[model samples]
Target: MHDLIPFIPGSVNDVLGSLPFFLPEIYLTALFILVLITNLLFGRNSEKLCRIIACAGILLVIQRDYQQIQLLFMSGRLNGQFLFNEMLLLNRTAINFKFIIDALAFVLLLYFGWDNRLKSHPKGLSDLYTIVIGSVLGLHLMAMAVNLLSIYLAIEMVSIASYLMVTYRSENAFGTEAGLKYVLFGAASSAMMLYGISLLYGFTGSLNLFSGNLLPGLIQANPVAVSFSLVLVLVGIGFKLSFVPIHFWVPDVYEGASTPVTAWLSTLPKIAGFALLINFLRPFVYFEKWDGFDFKLALSIIGIITMIAGNFAAIMQRNVKRMLAYSSIGHTGFALMAIVTYNSTGIAALTFYLAVYGLANIGALALATYFANALDADDMNSYKGLGLKYPAASVCFVIVLVSLTGLPISAGFTGKVLVFSSVYGIYQQNHNLWLLLLMITGALTTVVSLFYYIKIPLNLFLKRTEFVKNTLIKSQNIIVLSIIISVLIVLLGVWPDFLFKLF
Candidate 1:
């Protein structure tokens, strides 16, 4: 009975002492409040102002954290230690992840504000910007969460904001429906995770995973029951990460939502999900330290299944947005493969892939909206001969697609190579059959992914059709942003060592 109670102990002083390391979050919280106030004071008219504020805040945080990350790299020291009585951590990893989230937010807001469709919405985009700022705040915390309660809260924050963003335009039935589906799925996952957390607290007698009694208690718990509960906790994570078996929500949600929303969904949440998952598992994977079940093996199995399922499913998609949705699911699996390596190399690889993935996916979805507006069609069939008429866009789209397919001369290729190297190193060390299986699955899926990704280029070039008037993505900023992102993707591919050395 004593073990059934959660032990959560911390003092006010502890939280106070941790404030210095929590500056990134504090900055976000302040900005969230400022955005809210700005929205209220200016209402719909504040849309541009709010966007500027949101982007500026995110950029500032990015600068601060990036500098900190650089300092940590140069010093070759980890600044993250347990903070707030070990409920949160402040380390180089968390900082870098925060930087990624903030940087993506900054870029995304620029796209969102520049998108004429959203800019023309009657209610305006002010509220949405506030919501996004809040969401990033949650994700920032999610990356740093080391306690069960904090993790739960962080997931809820992101989920709630995502639901709102999906349903922002009540005029769009597809988006509203997607929002409803997301809510139902999100709630169920959260409930299941809560139950799992309760079970963990019961077994370990502590809310903190690394607490004195938690690990030993976990080891002594019934292996079967503990494994089941642990997986239950991961249900929420898998949902966010969009891994297979828990990825049913992705495609429809991606197709139904607007491009900017889809880009944010596919990138930030997934990165934070994997970061949290890896952080939570660190104690177990690194040590023969605490083991009642083989979590690493379980993760490996999921990774393989996700890669095979996501890539194969993408082959069946004709709608470009939905195809990329499934493609994002495949990337989720590839990320898991990196996470499974359970070391610094794995972390570096994961970080690099996520950075490139964010850039390419954002650029791809942006191009999707551009094409949809230009051709007035969402399917591959509509894209025929578009390459001839819009050579620049078609070429850039090809670049994005090439990167997504893990082709050479793109960041996706470099990301794949890094992951393969990590997985191979693990196999060499352990000769683990499971590791071997994941590696093979990852490689084979990369080849299979080529078929679907090729459809875009094929449609643009091979199939011939006349171009329609496209008013959707006429914004010069959007076009320029897409090209710049594509350029960065190729740069990262060619100079992978540039970022790798920083890590």
Candidate 2:
């Protein structure tokens, strides 16, 4: 008891010190509460106020994130600092991830009500704004989490928000079904993750990944058990990433959820999941004696399979959103190629690639909303000749899809090149067969992606339809923002330094 007395003041000092680094997330919690209060105070009439508040709050969060970035660079603290008893990390990479997530989230918050179907919800979008704010907080947590307990909690927070967002349109039976599926899959994955965490804690007697006890304990434990536990944890992160076998829930969820919600589901969580994966893998990757799990081989196999499956399956989808869903899976695989490299250059490339991909994806889905509002079109067959009818929307769709396909003069192209170069650089040094296979698979899948992505433009511009049922264009906001995103994509592609310099 006497010895423990000194620890109390130290713990208090740690919590107090963590607050500054945690400013963005603290603001997010307050934002969430503010939005909820606005919702309750004004009921359905709170939509606009909630949106305005949420958007403004996110921008402030982004500003805070920017400041953190400056502090990291200016203070020469490139190695990062630990907080909350080393359960979380405050570092350049984590800060960058939070910045990207918050920046995209600001756009998404503005986008939520732009979807005609979502805008027509009887309960209004106030609840959605609240959920998104909360989720952003969770996403920030995921980026910084260094302890197993924090990781599980952060994931669950975001997962719960996702469930609510997917099922927001409860009147839509399809959406409700998708939400049910998401919850079921999410629960199973969470259980596996928690069990894995339990096993690790039992083995190491510590929750912190970087703690002195973790690696030493794991090195001494049964290798098979350690590997199994690690794989199970990946199961949870994989569910968020929507990669390969864990990806079955993606298409159905994307197709069934509102376009804006699908946009959110595909981008932000996946970006943060990658951040989480990097955090989880870092300690193991750096420990030279640790060979309990071959992360490179496992991730390479997963990447190769994910690329092939996502791109090829996309070719068969007629529904535009569903096709984008598969396309996202393919992108996840491509990003994994960067992760497997496990180097500074690879990490930088991954950050840029994910940012570019996330922007293009949100733009693509926004166009989906645009057409759905303009012509009630959702599938390729229904898209025939609407290109001429709505040339701006069609052109934006083409540009975004071009980026997704990694064609030139688009950011996606630049991103893919960076990731490819990073992997090849690593391959040159190690001559790993897995790296070579990943590069080959990535290239082949890029070509395969063209087949499906091209189908959109072909239907939009080539296939002629004489009859059209058109509606008032209520999706102007979505169109305008998508065009801006498209221009940014091209700009970043042409001058990769615009984004690369940030990293």
Candidate 3:
């Protein structure tokens, strides 16, 4: 082999440049390798040790990255493009908000490890943590990727990891079926996205999304083809976000996967997917100025359809996971409203909304998982009399459900208000009557959403069913932590500025 000294200078500069921004992922990678090796060498007893290391690694990343984010913003590196030939961008906006994302991942990771449901299967626990860390690292990369190739790779990385997490318990038919469905659908979507990427590259002669200036010309030349390519790409994103017309696999996967994995699947990837959506749409924000391209109208139509379809379908669901899956689809539409505004305030609102929404969803899923394990049922009917049997847990569930419904004095309400006001501002400036119609539709959907959301409390508190032994098993630390998150949800709703200030 050639002497290493010849490449030392260039390699050193690359390493140094990528070091600070990649610290969190690097830490995770190291911990993941350690966990794998320890499991192989030290046997099953070392599973808990791996969990501790994973949790510590994630927390350390969050703390270090949070400080790094502040420093980067203070130093005016918010928009700085670092190593890898500018494929990776370290922006203040992404950096500040991604710290919160990392923290959210830490909370979910802690819950995944500490939940008693997974404690008996040590090897599975280790494998699950490894997959989670891998997916989280992919998400971190996705938020910063500036090229089409990096974007596709980041998405596929997360997708493959998620498929494994869904199929971890492969002995069961549900796990096997969910895994098969996910891989088949995911592979097809990825292939379509790749073809779209190839078309864009062939038309533009560049793969760097930020620097590529061919979209306007291509759209003018062939509006239909460009729109086709855009839709094809959105198929991949829509799968992750679980939007209408591309959400057929979500309920199956959610119902089949274990509750903890389902919780992670529902929240973290969706947040990252939305962030990617906002980033991709930045160039198309001035669609009116571009010849023959009406991206805003297209997005508005999709948002409207997603909202109506998601809300109407959710009304018929009795399975808790299935209902939440539909509810997530509706929230996807709500989040897309912020994207339609296409301004700094809209981005900020979407970021804050996603943070709170993810926290609440994860907390709710944790409680749901606990109840499912305790009662040995995942149906809504099993929740009957839970209000009296498990008052604290049931109350926490109510708070989370209320937040999901966007009721007053909850983060969900603040998120909805922010999205509505931003869209309203856009409407006032442009006199777009369609926005007002959508706003009204969104309001009506929220009311409809409340009916389904309240079903949990109704069954638990109001309707009495066959009485079972009301044994009070001490709450897991994870459950208590989830409740604390619910408290933050309400606090952020009451004082919306608390999070906005960080960005």
**Candidate 3 lDDT, tens digit per residue, 103-205?**
8877887777655555555365776777777888888777777677887898999999998888876536876798799889999999998898887777767
Quote model 2's TM-score: 0.98
Off by over 4 Å in 1: 1-10, 70-79, 466-473
lDDT of 2 at 176: 85
lDDT of 1: 0.84
User: Residue 457 in candidate 3 has what lDDT?
Assistant: 94
Higher-ranked by TM-score: 1 or 2: 2
Clashing pairs in 1: 80-90, 80-91
- TM-score for each of the candidates: 0.95, 0.98, 0.93
lDDT of 2 at 287: 88
TM-score, cand. 3 vs. native = 0.93
Residue range with the least summed lDDT across 10 consecutive positions in model 2:
470-479
lDDT of 1 by residue, 44-63 (tens): 88988998889888888887
lDDT of 2 by residue, 1-503 (tens): 89999799999999997787788889999999999999999999989999999999999999999888777777677799888999899998999899899999989988887888899888889998999999999999999999999999999999999999999885468778888998999999999989998998899898888876988999999999999998999999999999988999999999999999999999999999999999999998998888788888899999999999999999999999999999999999999999999899999999999999999999999998888887788899998888888888889989999999999999999999999999999999999999999999999999999999999899989999878885767577887898899899989989999889888
Which candidate leads the pack in lDDT?
2
Assess the local accuracy of residue 470 in candidate 2 as a C-alpha lDDT between 0 and 100.
Answer: 58
